[model samples]
Target: MSVTESKAKTSVKTSKKNVKPAEAAALKEALEAAQIELVPLSALIKSPLNVRTIPYPVESVRELAESIETIGLIQNLVVHTLPEGMSGVAAGGRRLAALQLLLTENRIDAGYQVIVKRVSDELAVVASMVENNQRVAMHPAEQIAGFRKLSEQGKSPAQIGDQLGYGSRHVQRMLKLAHLAPEILELLANNTLDVEQCQALSLESDQARQVQVYEQVKAAYSTVSAHLIKRVITETEISVTHPRFVFIGRETYEAAGGVVREDLFSQEENDGTADRVLVDRLVMEKLETAALAIELNEDWSWSIGRENPLQNYGEDRENYLLLPVPEPQYTPDEQQRLDELYATQAATETYEDEAAIQVLIDEIESQAAHRQWTDEQKASCGVVACLHNGELCILRGIQKKVKTPGEADAATQATSRDLHVIDRKEPDAAEGISLPLLKKCLPNAHWLFRLPWYNSHRKQWP
Candidate 1:
């Protein structure tokens, strides 16, 4: 017989036959304690006031069922006696579903007994709420350890998945954590490393490398994402879609022995697939070299190529007292082009077709670029090229510092406009005006001031 059947046979009420008063009292007290009775599956019903009236997640219920089938019910269900000799389950609704599933699969019979505790209606309701509300979910680290133990104990991935209500892939993913270094695993246990980061680190074959990257990232950033960790470990450079890469051409970059990191899971669509990243910074610098060569060919006074334009520009300003500020001035032709661009933009408000809208956008951008910097402006002003909207943009006519030799008390002012001052004191009232005339003309004057001044000047008044 099953454990449930064995327990059920001894769970029924027993006769308190001929006994001493003390023995009777002891039996009575024993009844107050929760007793494990294996009640029949057919006798069990759901409580209307049960906290979990709705079905639990199917996967969770399935897992519970698998566990019960494998190891028997571990916890006793809190139940209350209902009318017509029936028992209603106030708690363990998921357990009931799991038993039902086992019965359906012929793993257990309808007469299978489930361990339960008989309680009062009020106690049953409270028990149900407490059971659900006070329950804590197991941490991922704990789950990993559990699954690893099961695996070591001869449980296959499929078997583990079946017993845990998880898919085979999920089981496999969990198992992968077993390969992590002990230190890294300890980090996960203490909440230092999150699940996603752990998963990303798992992609690397070397535990030492994983630990190294984890420590490096944890030191640098408050939180490290999977994508960032992947990029770091992969040593990939800027994306091919970057404007500088496009400007230099992928063929030229690859011919120079640059590595490309392609997304392993990306798919090709009608438009295109995900862009790959360039992995060698040295090869990337070839574009800078080429640019420098062209700039030198133009006979520039001085030219420098840098991977990061803003940092270079900032460094250039560090030694100087002040940065050059570019003042933008438009020639007559450029101003006309700007006006035409604005006119076309206004015309687009009436455009309805997609093609026409795209054409208008192209025209607007072209005009804007054309009028951006005139030849005269480029000749006299400096330029900066930096990343903008994942592309390269050239900013022209940045101002250089003005040389003021031997000037004292140099200060930077946001603006040179004169401050406007307002005088609050009004024109003094006529010195010899009559008191009655003054009161009549200044009807809004304070009564107290008028009365005191009038009384003091009574002898001088007309």
Candidate 2:
């Protein structure tokens, strides 16, 4: 029987927070709520009056399905039942979707029992709106605290995760957040610090160090992201994946008493199944020391190992721009090798085979090794190390300016140079010019030629 025609009727228990004052009062007198019923999966239908408008993320829906599979549905679906074999979901659309996913996966049968609360059409929209919009989401800090409490009650991360329907790793990460300084947690609650920043902060186990790093960034900038926080905290460290480290060789670096810091969480690049070293400050220094030897051989009067902001801008900005580095020229043999590498790469690309692709990769590496800087270019240029796209980029042979007589002021020269660099023919004038107008500029071009427009419109003897 339809919910409207059923003999059973119960008054809805409404909370002030879940329902509006008018909705609560109106529902109290005008509508009758029904008790929960176990209906077949095929009998229920999604409500057109459902209040959820935003599409849920696919990942979230998938996780919900996992949760449902792990520990059956905890909540009942609300539906408005009609007499003509039509039923619409009034609330719990997400749960319904989860159930549907289970059915498609053959995890559940067509006649699988679904707990549903049948309501009348009159209260459908309001019931959906209340269920979706009224329930507030818990703050992240509170969630972390709850997880920590569960851990304190002698539950392992895996056990807690199983009960909560979350991954063990996620549960452990949440528990870690509960250890953050209360001040930092308060900032997170206030929405001043985001989840990423908190995660970065959690990297430092020492509470004092976290606060110190936080203050350092806060004092320097108005706002900070997780990347900025990590940059400040790991200022001395360098990724082992850095090209400079590979060039120096790990054995030579370790012989020089350099240490490599490995991340316990991340895996190896080759197999992606084994743990590997992540970063090293000592090894980075050893690599820099090796680079310094190269710097000495170049014989610059004076040079800094790193890029100096003062040297790149302000009083030195003009000098930096007025002088340009000479482009490296390759010898004939080098050019031939490069051409061979390009041909090999092209051949490998044409035949989509793995072995050919591997050979192409090796040839490209050889091509890079063959190219060398000219002696004169190296003599005049000094090397500077700078981070480019988060990797060490060694800039060789950057020239120093020699003052020239009768030169324009730096600002004016810079503006003129900027305009020259961006110079291009604008499309507006070129696109509008007609063939007749274009021909007018040519020698003896005026009456010798008639355009189609002129020839077609002119009066002719017939």
Candidate 3:
């Protein structure tokens, strides 16, 4: 047999908790001390004032009763027969249902009262549900539905309360759930939403409004429950006015003719470099500016930032914004043109043109040929930073300092210097005379003497 059937068979009562062996022994001892009788199902006549006039249904109770009537009632149910000889359950709904069914099926008399251990009404109810449904929990939604059905049938909350043995407040709370929309009801059943959502929903009058926001909430997170939604909905406004979230499918992105550059995410994952992010920053800035420019009215325009990884990621690296913008739209003809013009992604790079980069390579190689560099590119490797003409230039491995006697004397005068002076160590060939001295220079000639950037931070250089 399945566990349910086996449990039902072994259980002496419906809606009753199982006995702890020690507790059961204690109860047995108490029963003996109280002088209670263990009566068979065949004894104790039913009272005229039974509160539950309509008996609960039971199966196989008849067979059991017949077996008892013929073989004699075996395994008498425990009971604390009152001085008045009345019967009530301490722990047996199933046993009572079986016996009652037997009587109803004419296998036994209706007047029979099955024995049960006498205990507090509280203990009886708690135990009853535990014995039957610790595994099969009656959902809160179903309970509310049942209460609503009874209420609709003209049962007052108090009457329902008495019948269910609960306070009127609980009945009212359950009744409120019936007011929510059908979709919300389903969420409750599915346990996607909970009491909190319901409580918040109760405050709202508009069903459509509730539904619109509910869908947004459901879309935002996969695992939240209906009860939770109820709670969240009250305090958090998730609906149309500044809706809490936007689920923009890629269609939306491409719909605006966004020409995506290289997928930054893939590059970020691959290179893990500051340079890649710099490209992203520039792209986002261009995209935002472009978006603003295209819109006829600034009031109607919208833009979103590329998420700042540092703001969210770490303290070691200060937060930096990604300035990239959405790609400009492509007209069909322009797209065709771009598709033909560019051969590969290398063609999309912005910082360098092929001719310009080739020139820089030639410059560095030529400098390397004559400069005395320790390791060419690294520290103490006799390198000078310089901006030759206008292009960014890096001359590697220059051995000699290009100072004339006067320049050498000036260098001695400019002491007590910060990192800029130290960094300005890259020699500017325009300011000096030595081929190898040009080695170790910044390709961008402008950076040779002092960059405006470092100066803003209060650092100065010669």
RMSD of each: 23.6, 21.8, 23.6
Residue-level lDDT of model 3, residues 241-359, one tens digit each, is 11111222223333544322221112142111112233334435543444344222222223232222112123311211222111234456644543443333135354355334433
Best by TM-score: 2
Query: RMSD, model 1, all Cα superposed?
Result: 23.6
- Cα lDDT of candidate 1 equals 0.54
- lDDT of each residue in 59-126, candidate 1, tens digit only: 98889898888898998888989988889897787788899888888989989988888877655544
Per-residue CA lDDT of model 2 for 180-251, tens digit only, reads: 888887777666776667777876667788888898998888777667777776666655566546545566
Question: In candidate 3, residue 445 scores what lDDT?
Answer: 53
TM-score of 3: 0.27
Q: How do all models score by TM-score?
A: 0.29, 0.32, 0.27
2 or 3: which has the higher lDDT?
2
Clashing pairs in 1: 324-399, 324-400, 324-401, 325-399, 326-399
User: After superposition, which runs of candidate 2 have C-alpha atoms over 4 Å from their true positions?
Assistant: 1-135, 190-192, 224-227, 244-462
Clashes (candidate 1): 5
Q: Ten residues in a row with the worst lDDT in model 1?
A: 419-428
